[model samples]
Target: MLLLLLFLSLPPLSAAQLCHPNDLAALLAFKNSFSNPNSSLPSWDPQFHCCNWYGVECNDTTNRVLGLDIASVDLHGTIPPSLSKLHHLQRLRLHKLPNLVGPIPPELGQLPLLGYLVISWTNISGPIPSFLTNLRSLSYLILSFNRLSGPIPPSLPSLPYLYAIDLSRNLLTGPIPESFGHFLLSTALDLSHNMLSGDIPASLGNVNFSRIKLSRNKLSGDASVLFGKDKVADTIDISRNSFEFDFSKVGFMESLDVLDISHNKIYGSIPKQITEAVYLQFLNVSYNRMCGEIPTGWKLKYRSESWDNSSFFHNRCLCGVPLDPCK
Candidate 1:
């Protein structure tokens, strides 16, 4: 009996806690599909329990695969469809694997418990599958910096729990969807650096996103609606687009930290009320069709960051402390 107690106390059986064999096979199959040029996947050998493998996590009670994060590991190859066999997976992040190219397998949408799915900065291309709208448990979805093309999937907003989405720096085209306003839980939505066009959806004004970035696209239309009475987003960057809206209608925002709307067709006098935004730290309205004297309060009182003469340059007409005094 003393020998039995000593054996039990030595160190609770480590590898003897067997994981579900099917889950082990699924993970082994996932590792087998990738060509590991940097030897980043050495620990994924099938000889060991999959739960002990690098970048794989399993439930303590059920021993089912629950998470897989193979980010920035120089992994190459398409995401294996076998990963869908991880029926209990809740989080999967495959970020910054630049050499990993190919379409995301639609089979991945089958992971019923997936709550966080991020596949950023890779070479993945193709339209985002519309079936991802059924991921009821998803709250954070990031597919940024890929080669993905096609309109933002119209069915994407159907994920009721989704709160943040980043599809930035892709090859996507087409207008922002009208249903975007329905993402009531979203606080951050970035669709920047794509070839998107068409009018900004007026409905976007209804959503209370705290950060919205629609910059470096070909979007056109009056943007006054985005800056209208709802006034929630604190960081709004719509610069480098073809949007047209007078500065007068760009209402005051008390919470604004950064505002960039440069290189557009916006024309009109800079609104003096813009100075009322004490929280404003960064403002870029240059390279537009704007004209008239710069607001004195903005020129003298604002100094959150260093400004170059170019910040006010290239306007249709302007004069003030920053621009040789409107003569």
Candidate 2:
């Protein structure tokens, strides 16, 4: 009768009890807040288990929710704070929810296990929550293409494992934190297409980013740190800024493939150092105050069409293989 008693005491494993009661309640609360016209959560019914729901994943042993990815689902309405109840949640992606408005709920900081948080292409606005710094396990964070404004929280760089941050195409203003160099293993850092102004932090050169896009901002000053020695950045786009560095600084980027520093106040001759970039594919230094001969790099040699000519045009006095002779 001991085995019979144990079996009788076990919870039912039917569809009626598909998920942990607390997780189910949280999911229901989350679903109730959104206007899901497409019926993305048709299976999100109390009669069935939440583990079987459209965008939910649960751990097999403990039955705790582990991942929730409802990206690009046309989810409208603010994120429900009840989601913090899922203590086991490790990866949460709610990207491209253009209709989801309002500030990111501070309740997200309560998720102790969250490692990857991607909420890009949303209409969420307000200052990035400082509580995010408390989430030490966070590694990949992409909050790009949103209406989020205010200076990026400096506490973010202090996150021990954070390796990627993309806040581009937003209304974010103010200087980028010099502490950004603390992301020792970061591969990509993009803060482009914002209203951010001030000198590009020289400390950014300390980290070895593979791609750095600070284009179309109001940034100015000596950007030499970005391309100077120890820079392992391969693709860099700082175009349409007020940076006044000489073109010669680009020589250090031997691994560069795409370089667009156009429409800046940069001047001086197109130095031979740039030719050292054997991997250069796309080069646009146009619309600047640069003068003298275009380097005889293999990529710039046999180019045709006005677009090619346009790349070297609008400068003070550029001539050679690409453009017509200096007059």
Candidate 3:
């Protein structure tokens, strides 16, 4: 009779407690630390429940926070540690928040159900958290336009279902990880405008991609590493780097639509392969140490500015087409 009486007295677990109650309190504590200059996040009042807060959504059935979408809110201050409390969170969007600063909390990797994470255009610095690889269910990740630095994490290739990745406009350095070849289903991979150095990873030539950008870095080596067996569409910008190679030897040059290798140290005669790229719309090999007869082609005539530089002066051995024949 005593055991039965004790069971009857215990309070049942409610759906509101799907996750720990302290999770809610933690988010509230974070709000307390920052100054909301615009009063835009007024929904973060202490008296009201978190479910009523702006940019936060809860599942109706479990009353658990499921989504946090705060794009372009001009929100300033560091990301709150309390967010890890939302164990059921599926989407976290915090784009265009220029005032957002500090490293992304590695604790965020604990969200098992997270699918979409967009934190672009912030001032967040430091290496990408390795813990983020724990989000096995994530599909879209955009960390573009930030102050993130360090080698690209090799673990990123483990994300089997990832479709798009944009890490452009940062201070990331180091060779492209060999594991990047594993992203067979990826549609876009943008690593442009970083301090990335070393030869383009040869493994990249094996993976299929819709768009690839490695422009404006200190990357070196031949251009042949990009053209895999598959036909890639969109742009290829390796421009503004120190790539040194014989353009005549490049293999499978027909797949690209836009190829820009300007401002490099490349040399040798333009190859006949240039005419084979029938779909080529934009080609800029200007300001390189290239010489010999210019390859006669459909679009080559219009790219005068790309080829009219003093570097061509050293190649006095020969020239023709748009340029005065070597005196």
Candidate 4:
């Protein structure tokens, strides 16, 4: 009789009690203040609970809210600080919400169980909150094409599980932090189209990468030394900057498919060694002080625009390919 009484007294699991009270309260608070221009967010009535909310998902056994996806929802307002209350949240996608503004909440870093985060193409501005470095379980973080400014925090590399990080197309200024080299496990690191200025960190050459784009910045120094022979994938774009150095000593990019180092202050001859890049498909080194016979090779013969320039007029020493032989 005692066992039966104990069993009968236990509250039954139901959708109404899907999440922790605090978690539910936090979600409701966020919904109340933010303007959802499209009315895409589902009715977050407490009686119905979060289980039926548009983008939210609950763990079947625990009934705790585990995901929040608001991608392209036209959400406007600051990221609610109360979002941290949902300790079990595993995925958060707020991509392309141009209306969203204000600093990314530091409280987001307090989520111990979070995994995926995508806020790209939003109006979110300010330094990436330092608290984010604590997300040790993060696998994918995409904040590219935002208005975020300031130095990328050095602590980012400490996250052992991070695989993809895209911070391109921001106003971020400062040297590519030396800490970037610590992300040896990263698959794609895109820091392009920023105001970052400094020598390409040589340490980056040590990390194996699949696609690395550092183009259209104020970055300088010899490109050859900055990208070591890592035999990874096939893309490296460091074009449209003030890099000035000799390209002759630079070794071949055997695995490279696209290389765009155009419109820079680079001064030197296109080294014969470059012909060894067997897999090169796209090459653009135009508008620089490159002089000498364009190495007759499979890639160069087809890419006519790869050698365009007024620099050829200044570089009286250059010859062959698009230009007539040295006079």
Candidate ranking under TM-score, highest first, comes to: 1, 2, 4, 3
lDDT of 3 by residue, 167-233 (tens): 8999999988888877847457889999999987777766666778888999887756665335564
Q: Ten consecutive residues with minimal summed lDDT in candidate 4?
A: 302-311
Better of 3 and 4 by TM-score: 4
Give the Cα error of residue 107 in candidate 2, in Å.
1.0
Expressed as tens digits, the lDDT of each residue in 190-273 for candidate 2 is 899999899888887778888889999999987767775456677889899999977754555677777888999998887777
Pairs in steric clash, model 4? 18-63
- Quote model 1's TM-score: 0.89
**TM-score for model 4?**
0.83
**By lDDT, who's the top model here?**
1
Candidate 2 Cα outliers beyond 4 Å, as residue runs? 1-12, 35-40, 299-307
Instruction: Give the deviation of candidate 4 from the true structure as CA RMSD.
Output: 4.1
lDDT of 3 at 191: 91
| TM-score of every model versus the real structure | 0.89, 0.89, 0.75, 0.83
Q: Write down the TM-score for model 3.
A: 0.75
Clashes of 2: 1
Q: Residue 271 of model 2: what lDDT?
A: 75
Q: Can you list the residue pairs that collide in candidate 1?
A: 319-326, 320-326
Off by over 4 Å in 3: 1-33, 43-66, 251-255, 269-279, 292-327
